[model samples]
Target chain A: MKDVSEMYIPTYDDVLEAHERIAPYIHRTPVLTSSYFNELTGAELFFKCENFQKAGAFKVRGASNAVFGLSEEDAAKGVCTHSSGNHALSLSYAAGRRGIPCNVVMPRTAPEAKKAAVRGYGGIITECEPSTTSREEVFAEVQAKTGGDFVHPYNDPRVIAGQGTCSREFMEQTGGVDMMVAPIGGGGMISGTCLTLSNIAPEVQIIASEPEQADDAYRSFKAGHIIADDAPETIADGLKVPLKERTWHFVSNYVSDILTASEQEIIDAMKLTWQRMKIVMEPSCAVPLATILKNKEKFAGKRVGVIVTGGNVDLDKLPWMLN
Target chain B: MKDVSEMYIPTYDDVLEAHERIAPYIHRTPVLTSSYFNELTGAELFFKCENFQKAGAFKVRGASNAVFGLSEEDAAKGVCTHSSGNHALSLSYAAGRRGIPCNVVMPRTAPEAKKAAVRGYGGIITECEPSTTSREEVFAEVQAKTGGDFVHPYNDPRVIAGQGTCSREFMEQTGGVDMMVAPIGGGGMISGTCLTLSNIAPEVQIIASEPEQADDAYRSFKAGHIIADDAPETIADGLKVPLKERTWHFVSNYVSDILTASEQEIIDAMKLTWQRMKIVMEPSCAVPLATILKNKEKFAGKRVGVIVTGGNVDLDKLPWMLN
Candidate 1:
């Protein structure tokens, strides 16, 4: 296991290195444009579609970088993480590609489909109660038993640097956008956007979109410090996690603003994207669009880039269907 | 209106002209690949995503060609068609783009979503009973009243030439595939694929996919003649129509084979695509994937191009949601 006593921040050079290292493992997912959305919001929207990424999320970029960056000695130990969603699947996918063992500590309450997907990638799952206390305890025990190197979902410098590659591609693909909007969960994607855009295209505004139900990142951005949320509920299950120190560093320094969207708004935007754009994306991915639609005046007539984070959702139980 | 006394079969030259003409309007949609599907069927699958095309279907290619090809006088008089599906929305979209009137004769029982989309695109709808006799009768009257050019959904050479552009782009994008698979609706898309591929890449085999319930094209292919069905039923609403003379020319000559899938198989493939590919496609679009999965041995180790026909579906009532 690697030492984690001191906080180490990843730089632009690390992001550039991560891009080259993970290029073979990750997909340069297509950038899509919707004329309907463009007309509705009066803004030229370029969708960075990471929903179609390997393992069906952008987290694969980070997970692949982390797994591949491991030294020969550390690689023998494999990797471990606690995620009920895309990160768990991504880490499993990356580890499986390297032909290494991946241990996942998922909440027992996680969807059977998600559990099946992790297993589909040959991930070994250890279930825990749906609480931070239980998850931490279960994850520690699994890590100790498996002797696996820990790969934190978002806060890790390697993961953040890896996630930064998406924006580098976004900037190259779209030429340039006035603003880059992405859903902020643990702030992995947003922080990565900040880390990349702030260095390369500092003129471009980095906006963090959050679910109003779990707007800790938004609060943290306002409060000028990390604000933790306990079991905040929203249809966007991925955005419930609170931001940590590494993510907060980039968020505080580089993010222009943190906007939020309501649960109903997120659901509506998600359905709209599916209906018009013809892409299957998760509710969490809709937060950016929802906020953009709500604040049309700010984005109107500007070339905006929106990150469609992932497409890992339970099809049978789509959020809109429940209502 | 232009004369239609003789049936003008569209050639490769016409396809080239159509591509040039419609290049400005329609999207040169990206071709997506799925490793999961490739591993499952042992065939390399290249999906030409027309679901993301302008007006949410490949029909826009043909519709735009017909609408734009008209002489100043004919274009002023506008175009008309009888369709309850993608063709209606597509023609409406084309006419709207050209700043001309689009007359659509649709069954009054058609989904309200379809009616609204047609209206949203500035299409004037003339409702008739949900029967061929009623549709034809109403369509003829509407044409006589409006003095509009009758744009037959598939039979017209202009429409076929426009759809042919899709395969032209597909061939260019994929660097030529061993097989081209598409749903046999009224045979517009299939005929187009046959037209473009037969000339540019004659070595490529053309495969037509059909719903078992509406297997008129399959039966017609086997019987070596056109077999029109009076009224067939299937969940693939886009493929319920019988092939006309022009489409039959390509289907009988160029098409290597016609494959059929059961209702359950079609639905399963549609859901599987949504789940794994993370793309929103119509039930009709799923037909090719369904057929490919069923006949894996025939396509094994081959690079296959599958046309995702459209994305115009009622989201409130997805096929998998019905159960």
Candidate 2:
């Protein structure tokens, strides 16, 4: 096994550079402190609301940093990616700002709203079957056809560095947090968070929250092995991806623990955010709150930070968990 | 009418002082810019999202300033008000912070969600019949019983001064927008907006948007007389109040126009905000957007600022709005 510390981990300087690169392109989403949520869970919770971030998710931070970091000639060549939702929107928005053409390979089963948002931001979409085989096959065909540079959603070092920028901002906004929890989906956000926290505030415990149904990261972290699954079923559609080689190394080394929450808990937290905070959060974004609610004893009376990943849920399809 | 130009209009300096007075007690709600809205309206639209403000409305800005500006002895005596919804929640939250009791006289027809929010913030509710006579009668009885100071929702000079803080923040963020529009209920928001714009950005046009069914402000502004109706029908529950004396003087002098939008237009804008901006806004908050959409020619290609007043709509009641 490769020594995890030797793996590609972003330094504080790298994150600072990424922040500077994306400063003009992306919004520094505010950290909203919820006294209502604190009273309910007995923890001082600072919700890093990336739901209000540009392109409606933290994905924009990484996508903007990567696209802007590219040379003018390379950017003119354009960018390509395969994503079911938020990543596609971010890449499309980032590319739109630079007037670069973006092609996204999205699963046919992806929500219409997600597809509309991607196209709305000027990304050309090609529908593929809902499997790894189909995504890679379709992406390769599109890459060959368009000659666009492929941007991996999570595995790329640049993308990880970009994701670290969110944590850097989080720490700056909130002087120093004792613990930070973020939802693990494709391991992109968590990997960046881990890398950034490891350098800036090594004492701050970094915890990963995953949907129990899609517990590949939790299982992999526990067993100290790369766990790849053909398919996973969870309402957190973003977390369906198993950890890739680059992300797996960072998670194993820097993440203190990976906690799992039930699908019902995710839905409940989503409803709670909507009702109490009046913020429309998607199910995947609610995983951190779900983990905190389920394991209150672990976080009681502590200044804990939770990343609310996104707010792209369809109004017509709110989860039945509230009822 | 007593030389409107010489009327007591709050200065930018006064707004600055109010901001400082209420800074600790009030939230600095984020200013959300919508590219989608800009594309749709052909205007660079900045939504001063008071929906995300504390107590879910801009009322908290005024309520906090009013309550906190009181002497320590006066604060200890508590505060009372008669409001259909938002002001009640704002007063409750502000009073709760001071550890003082609040008595809210509300119509029995008030929404359950609002009532629950008021109670959640530790407010005492006094239910009254849904009429001006009943509301006044009940409020007088409550004031006589509790000896609490009456923090008039929109009529009080302190309340109007409090609302001015929003425009002060807006001017600082956007730096001299071409036009500013806010919904007109009893004109607390617009009155404050006009005062702030008059002092800071004197060249900016101040427009007031009102629901057609509740166009008392429009009528009154045109005829140069107070228009008081026994009852008005509108889904914009927030705009039911007739113009008060202090607000009337400001609106009469500083407001460029009072535009009216149909209930359907307001509902459409509400839906569009939810679908496109991913922000929850009530009918009253949507009035400005609705007016802009309905009269596109007037606002087209201009830098427009809209105050999204609040987001306290009941989720269950939304499906019925489609009808």
Q: Give the winner by TM-score.
A: 1
Give per-residue CA lDDT, model 1, range B100-195, as digits (tens).
999999988776767888999999999998766788899999999999899888889999999999999998898989999999978999999999
DockQ for each numbered candidate:
0.84, 0.35
- Model 2 CA lDDT for position B52: 81
Each candidate's chain B TM-score?
Answer: 0.97, 0.95
Native-contact recovery for every candidate?
0.81, 0.28
User: What digit string (tens of lDDT, one per residue) describes model 1 on residues A1-323?
Assistant: 23444698888998989999999999999999988999999999999999999999999999999999999898999999998588999999999999999999998877677788999999999999876678889998999899998999998989999999999999999999999999998999998999999899999998999999999999899999999876788888888788999999999999999999999999999999998999999999999999999999999999999999999888888888896
TM-scores of the candidates, chain A only: 0.98, 0.95
Over 4 Å off, model 1: A1-4, B1-3
Candidate 2 ranges beyond 4 A from true positions? A1-20, A65-78, A137-147, A320-323, B1-21, B69-77, B129-134, B144-147, B199-201, B275-278, B300-303, B319-321
How displaced is residue A115 in candidate 1, in Å?
1.9
Give the lowest summed-lDDT range of ten residues in model 1 chain B: B1-10
DockQ of 2: 0.35
